[model samples]
Target: MSSGGSAQRPEGLGTRTSRGIYVSATTPGSGKSLVALGLAEALHSHTDRIGFFKPVVAGTTPDADPMVALIRSRYNLDPAVCRGGLTAREVRKYLAEGKREEIGARTVDVFSEIAAQCDVVVVEGTDLVGQDSAVEFALNARLANDLGCPMVAVVSGRDRTPEEIADAVDVARKELQAAHCSLLMMMVNRAAPQHLDEISAAIRPGVSHRPVYVIPEIEEISRPTTGEVSSLLALRQIAGRADMEREVRDVKVAAMSVANFIGVLETGDLVIVPGDRADIMVGALASTFSPEFPVPSAMILTGGLSPDEHILPLLAPAPFPIFAYPEDTYHAARSVSEVRSEIWSGQRRKVASALGAWSKRVDDAEILERLNLPRPETMTPLRFLHELVGRARVDRRHIVLPEGTDVRILRAAEILHRRDVCDLTILGDDGQVREIAGSNGISLSGMPILNPATSDLRERFAHEYARLRAHRGVDLPRALEAMLDVSYFGTMMVQLGLVDGMVSGAAHTTAHTIRPALEFVKTSPGVKVVSSVFFMLLPDRVLVYGDCAVNPEPDAEQLADIAIASAETAAQFGVLPRVAMLSYSTGASGSGATVDKVRRATELVRERRPDLAVEGPIQYDAAVDASIAATKLPGSNVAGQATVFIFPDLNTGNNTYKAVQQSAGAVAVGPVLQGLRKPVNDLSRGCTVEDIVNTVAITAVQAQAVHAQTLQAQAG
Candidate 1:
């Protein structure tokens, strides 16, 4: 509804003509470029009209942009058709030299030229939703708007709130404007299969008009990083890293579980067995990247029974890390099988990373607590129980609702609550909810319940509505009716400030559940746009993407808004943001409306905010590959080494993303909404119990963030 400034729109200069879809998000790292690239790769099954773009880049490399190179090489586009003009170093120079006008002019020229040559362009973003001085976000959005292309929004699943999803869609739609585009689809990537139903239902209602696709979290591949291997084995670190070591090397590992040992074992390996019959086999793991081990890496000893304590002295001198589990051989093997995925996927170097951090902490127990511990053997209950009691504080009792919710979600909630992690407020017809639970073989003894039909609806609504709707919409009767119609009874409890957050949508669309929030709770002040994010879980990597669920075609400012949201999302996941601006041409090489949009957006980002790290007019390679980066752009943090990638438009956003999902076996989490006032989350109509639980967690986090912000504002 609100435009940032004239700079948000891009002026079109039709230069090149080609055919392809452009995938761009409101922000970078929202899986736009990856999606586009994947889609282009996937289209191999359909047609080959696919063309890639890094249309307008902020800087240049020695020869051209890395993204352009990828598009040229993989997508089969002509080198002449490729668009990135800037290198990583150039982008840094623009920032350092303070050449705002030069940056804008370069971007416009690049995109314009690429748009003229390519049939479809998959554009990526630098950032989309947060407020920052960066201009690239705005530039990507404007490129899409100017080019009149559609877009698909991508989001993550972890702790996503319905309000966030709704807000993202709302902002994107508002920014893109229905008049300029054909359609918009929101995709929640990396959603765990178990949570699919609940998440789908929760998010469906909010996006009924637009197509919302939910992709399951695909188990991805994870291999040891070179650093990880060196750290794990205490091998000498090598410079000039290559995919393969220069020569065949022998490595060994020793641990309590054969399963743990097997994960790090490569082909042609030898294994040691404890004097136990069960030592021979562990259950099959999800993957064995090397398929078979001709030789075992190492032999493991099981149980406290010493295959020899003498081995410990040997282990201490060995190159690999070792472990001692006080369990039987069979039990150790079982533990290994249970944690096979983790063992196989984890980098050997996480050990070094862990040890490094652990050394700084004074307490050893805390370090053990933080590690994602594998399943351990049962210990004596008395001492363990005593320790647990001593460490844990008393948990406050709260209402728990069954309300015919899915078993998995309820179980997850119970688990979290039992651990004293959260206090839940559940709504339902208590007795019926319980009866159904009993019939369904669900246990609810420890949970608290409340009946909304018999509860004081007026009082609850008054409380929540007073806080959320106060001056904005005060028609209590009308609001109540609206709320009831949309299952607002539960939402009202939250609105009235009676509850921390609400997670729904396992049985509804995002629209159905999020509508009430948008209509009642509204957006935070100065929050002009909404976008989505996806927490992609690759076998070995985790990433966050945005604006993949909403916004058909965003302007530079809107893209900027998405970028801010994405950066914050990345921060939550413990990743640093190094953004990439994608287009057909890199850094002013081409001329077109799309390039102009990216140019202005880059300028906007550099001039408006100097603290953030970002670069544009580069392709996926320049943004991700360090080797290509050194040769191409040389000194930029983002080029050929970027973690956050922005796409150009929706068609590119939707198809390309899914292609990656299906092909690379990458798991995706959200289309989590950003830029909302309150924390309300939606589940997919087909979401599972896990989805519901995760959505609840996401809502909690959002609620917490909003609360913290409110306190800060009040204090200020």
Candidate 2:
């Protein structure tokens, strides 16, 4: 909220319609950053998937939007999202080319990418550059309208009379109305204590359509920390290093006599003057000790000077802090005054104080009810992942990673830990894994690291695996030898309930990852073979593509089992279970071995579970497009609304899923293995850190489903 202006009401960065709120400011210094933080805090109470996006930011590092960085770290969000935006240079270039609409388009593109990741993205309203206030705010209004998100206007309450604040709020409201963007509310941030009630009542009649709230200035959050002053103003702290987090309540230039300046001394004040003013410097230091005098929080010796060499001895004896700056007194004082309040990522004390202040000042119950945003009816990749993480946490599962020596696995493990998605155990030597993590700047500080070769559980797991594989001619010695392998050790852990599930194969082959599980852990009851599905995240909904991984080919019966299992997997992850038996034909239009197999598989699915909606021998186009469905398969329930597509073989399923993933920019989640007794998943060897994290999350959620089924069976 420190970027500029008072805090926003509700944080919303909408990639989808009706998902986020745009918080904009009509005037400079409205603390939009803090307002956004306030909104996000409230959003956290209802849901954890909050996103922060700033469409354009100037005078900051590229790709480091101050707002996005602050909120992402504070919320422990997946860093993959909300980081993309048009830089100031890009925006200016677009504006100069008269392609301003393109800016909106790009912002929307960024929104879509993050939209999949966040339940509600807290889109920081477009920052005003050098444009006129009217022009900038009008653009924000239009952008909000274009993004189809509600707008909450922030009005600066600092140094402004109630009337001035009301007029500004009125202007912003009109801009939003003129652009046809829904105005959610108006907030007056940093309002003077005396004007809180007055400011709330003043933005009325003309502003009556939406609610108005006023937040009084909190000095701790509204004033810059001494640390910021030192860093921003280049005021080198020669003393009082311990008090860097203290807030500068007031800034004073020591142009007056020592006596007069002493009169102005107050708690948390930063005094600026020429360094040669030894009398004032000594007096200011002494004031901290007097019962009659107020203590100065810090002092800056301007003109590139410090306290006289002799006088420096008396400095630290006093509790007051001091700084040395190169600028003259006038400029130094001006610079200190210009330092605005902010919430930075690492500034814990300030952020904590700011959040605490906003929590107390804002009315929570009333605001949450008024800004009641509806949940997205469509499932997005990010939203689905959010749901998966949420589900995994609800019935917390302990997931193990067999490729702990790989950096991707460690990074993912750190992410899973940071997000609190599930309990995790990494399979490798503790020292090697730890060294790799540290070398990559990754922290698995509190995570469990189990060395498969040395773990005491290996003895128990060896016995369990040997007993389960005795028919395969395995003995205790052979099983004990297998226990040294990470995949085998990890699978054995899952089978024996040492851990709930295993996610491997990032560094191993598919056979290397799943063979152990297949050999001992085995498939669940009534399951024939382990099959897989890829949840293709199309623009509007999620579609399941089955038989994509494990099995290369299957008989009609195995295909039917895949269909049935895929339907259940879809339901478990919150997708509807409409089965489309995909082939090269639509209905009876064509015939081939593949087509016939799909048709038979469809009949078998219907026979096994009449509750599932199933359609067979359906072309891809007919299964997805309504017009094609009407022409090819009239009166069919699953033809056009198919949520699960059952491919006849692994070759087709794998090819189609990849084609869609690349051509349509769809997110392909898994080769999620189904029909396992306990959850075990594989990852691509070339998978990114995020891929590992997502797979681990999926595995944990799968483990949760497994646990639920076992509980139900025991009860029955």
Candidate 3:
């Protein structure tokens, strides 16, 4: 394998440039070139600026490749890059001498030219994993390393057992050390319809860590005609109905010149030029023999140029279909490139069939790339909730009131529902709730308030409570008293699948909410304790601090549980969870009960679930500061930076987060509830209407998740 750093681009190059994709395979005759070409065409469809780089050709001549030539010609690129026809001598010599270094140099040189002018360059490697005969028999891995580009390994279509498939993948992974390179995804080309199931099953687990896309084979190659291309460019017709070889008919062509080439130009088209500059065109045309379309259709030379004598002779020797525009070559080219972007993007008649074919091949790559792209901030819940006000979903949304509900809580709920945030419901009567809200100056505009106290719920709940708690307790009065508590009743509404997730805790503690859930809704069987995550929003990134609001001074086992829960919650929010068990010191630096708890928690976490990405006993700075981490904990997974920070206790968790928020101006959103069997959030007693709405969204999401889980469980 060849090994070297990426070559730097020449300075002062134009902004228009291309990146290169080096497509490699495990073995020869695997359609690597075909796939590479298709990728180039697909990328071209997305962007006009691109260059194809094939660094090594075992049996090629002078960098000459017919496919490369076709792309250059079809795109109207500089002819100096026509490898198949122009670089035949060089390719032949390389093959004769087997001098791969020369090939590498030439490849780099060609790419340098492309990089300077293109946005992305696509480099297709020779067939097979280790086929580098043209360059010291170097491996593709080394080439990718040198190019400093990620690679997409292409495998062939064939029937194989899961083990066999995994074996093949294992070989590639081991050779490339993909874990370090982040070689994101892979493509399985030419898969058949019937083979998809078997292939998917075989590769799913093998490539589960990476995205694997299957590309079906196309039956034929379809190319658009040149006339159609021109028509499409001119917005005359949409092309690509037929294959590439179709004959093109005569079409109007626009040409610009300062010389007297109008007499040389065919008549049916319009030409723009200076009346006095016609001679400049003729002088240039006199020295050139490249075929031009016949036309004296129209000429508008700028600078008042008129047609010269030599222009007519030039026209006589030209073919049919020609017109002249008012600008020089420079302006004409600019106009064509701009006005024809649609045509360039498969908009014309000669739709490059290869481009479509290539798109199919790299469909998986596109998906993976999109997955890596950043999403809009508006998609976040906190941002979405700032606009939503009361009664958003149900017309008469049922709001449950827990015991000891305070005026602040009731007033906030009224504002939320009146603003259409939720339908307000109270444990007490409408009159009493109104009296309470009015006393607090709460405007319950559109709110539909209800009181469960005097309503039939006392009796209904009395009976339901007996039915649910018949053996647990005795005495109707005592049972009614217990059932009448807000936590018990509110939790009952959720358990009976009546309302969505409920938010409480103004007059209650976290233990109250936790107690009802454990008694009624219960925790997920897989979970031990209810952990929470706070979406800590710093000026730059959103940090997820977990078990901060819950789990005070948790033991190693509890910390492990918190770590797992936090990691999962982070994933739910689209973050690739990297759990960092935080402490005052990183690794083994500090000796203390808390440090041991964090370290032991990290170990327990790995023992319980080895698949998770967990790091422990890392200080805040070491967990988040790259510089500090590199100095103290080199190579530790969670040392340099962590997205999920797991604290050992509520004191550290709450205080640290509050300090960050107050002192650093961080927006500490959420103390989002996690590990519940169903989604229910506990709002801070001092929360605002906005907080209620956000909690509602979280509840809604949790409700949907519970519904989905029920269906999945039933199906299973």
Candidate 4:
């Protein structure tokens, strides 16, 4: 039954060029779908161009394969490629008629075509059912080898002793290895809580080459929803259709009196009783809506009877589903007990539960490392945005929003607060800020709002400002007047270490917002000039456009510094830095003073930081397109894979960023100022609430990096 070969040392399959993994199981009901879904989600954080393939599907039509549909819909994968793989009947018929060669060729051709277009693919194997067990095992092994991918074997641990679990894994591992398919990892699913340690210890020695993971049985993923039960039992809908998707954890038969039935009820319980039991039906429905009692998932009425007329209207508004069946109470209960919940397209709760459990239980880092899957080169817009918030939350930084009264700023503040991304302070009149927020439907209850004119820090900040600016200024009066302005006051907070960063410019000019920072916060110790970059979130990847909003026209050395700063910024934000110094012509194709400046800047960058992959005097097309780059700059490393784009001047950089932002519908997230002693970012006056939120998140992350560097320096 297995694809035959000598069992040699198990080597990892899938070279650096290979882009997929095959997930298979030794037995049916191994929770293979759960593992597949979780694996897809985990890979998504690394790359968005993930593909799913279920070669040898079970049903005739695509709709019968719900897992494929669910993965496609949830991750927004291409529909054309996401249809289920070959049907089970087709494969089974071919195998029965000894058409193994045809099946193998077709599977390889189809999988190659799909894998070529994706960064990674997850291939699910056929279920091992009665009479087809040997054929299924052979097919899974042959497909894994033919696809040039590693195999993840899942073993069902339910009702199995420790020795049995180990035996199952050992046999599967040896079979897969003999078929020349590398075993990436083995997962023992649905094992008893107390038996998990024993089972792991038993299987550890048998599969010592690869890791073994044991996922405890989770009921949330195992229980059927009310809608599924209705479909399974052919029951008639009484009412509460809106709540049909609620999950059923336990099923109870209410044959006793109402008092005793109430005591036995639990949350997500499905009650089965005769329709004539008015007391049980009414009480079950009432408890679902009550705050004091456990809410049942649904109520099943049996015995071909109906509830009282008054109960019908109440059922309509119940928080759970109500079903009526013609079968007697005993038969209905028996039918319910045998129902098995399955993972389907519409069961979003179950999908989410599976992903959560897998993320918590699996050691994904070790698996990815063993597979030799490198870090992805590009990031999607959504993943980038989420990573910003997640990175900020790890070490919460205090951010101050000076333009707090502006509606967009207030809205962004509310969102950041709800996400718990950062600790925030707003410098403005407390009462006026609350009033404006209330009118705009935003809550600022727990956020601190201060008025510089009435605050205790006003005098202290004014004194500090006067002392810092003593050579140019006369007295404390001028400093006090400047402190009344929110921008100046907020910048003082960052300078005094009261807040880690400040985001302004929503309603103010960039000059007005950054003037105080330039005066007091200044650049980092080694940096002579401060610069900024915009994170242009294009459809496929994120690009960094630097000095777009700063340094209008720089000389050669300044441009070099900007290039280095932009590269560092890109690396900090999870983008690999392949810098392209953009100009009007490809390398040495044309000559002019502008071109000369770029060429000199490129040389300066190479001289200063030899580690950076940089190329210059390149046109935009050559910098981003591989074919053009091949013709223009044949051996240049950074020409075709540029992630950080450094512009020659403000006129070129600003216009290009705007054109791309408007035409391509890209999300430009900065004007993020770099080289500051602390982190101070300026927003566009035309920015949206989302733009402000993103800026604050970026600021928080920047502050965290700065803090980490400082700690390292002190320890050294």
Give Cα-based local distance difference scores for all models: 0.48, 0.76, 0.55, 0.81
Q: Return the TM-score for each candidate structure.
A: 0.43, 0.59, 0.44, 0.60
Ordering by lDDT: 4, 2, 3, 1
lDDT (Cα, tens digit) per residue for candidate 4, span 187-294: 988888788789888985443455588876767668888878888899888886455666787899998999999989876788998988988887876554444566
Q: Identify the runs in model 4 with alpha carbons over 4 angstroms from their true place.
A: 1-19, 45-48, 178-180, 194-198, 205-208, 234-237, 344-346, 373-375, 382-538, 543-572, 575-716
The local distance difference test score of model 2 is 0.76
Residue 416 of model 3 has an lDDT of 45
Q: In candidate 3, residue 394 scores what lDDT?
A: 23
Off by over 4 Å in 2: 1-65, 68-370
Q: Could you tell me the lDDT of residue 580 within candidate 4?
A: 96
lDDT of 2 by residue, 92-182 (tens): 7887798877888887777777777767777787655454566677667766766666777788889999998888877766655556666
Model 4, position 525, has a per-residue lDDT of: 77
lDDT of 4 at 595: 91
Ordered from best to worst TM-score, the candidate numbers read: 4, 2, 3, 1
- The 10-residue segment of model 3 with minimum total lDDT is 236-245
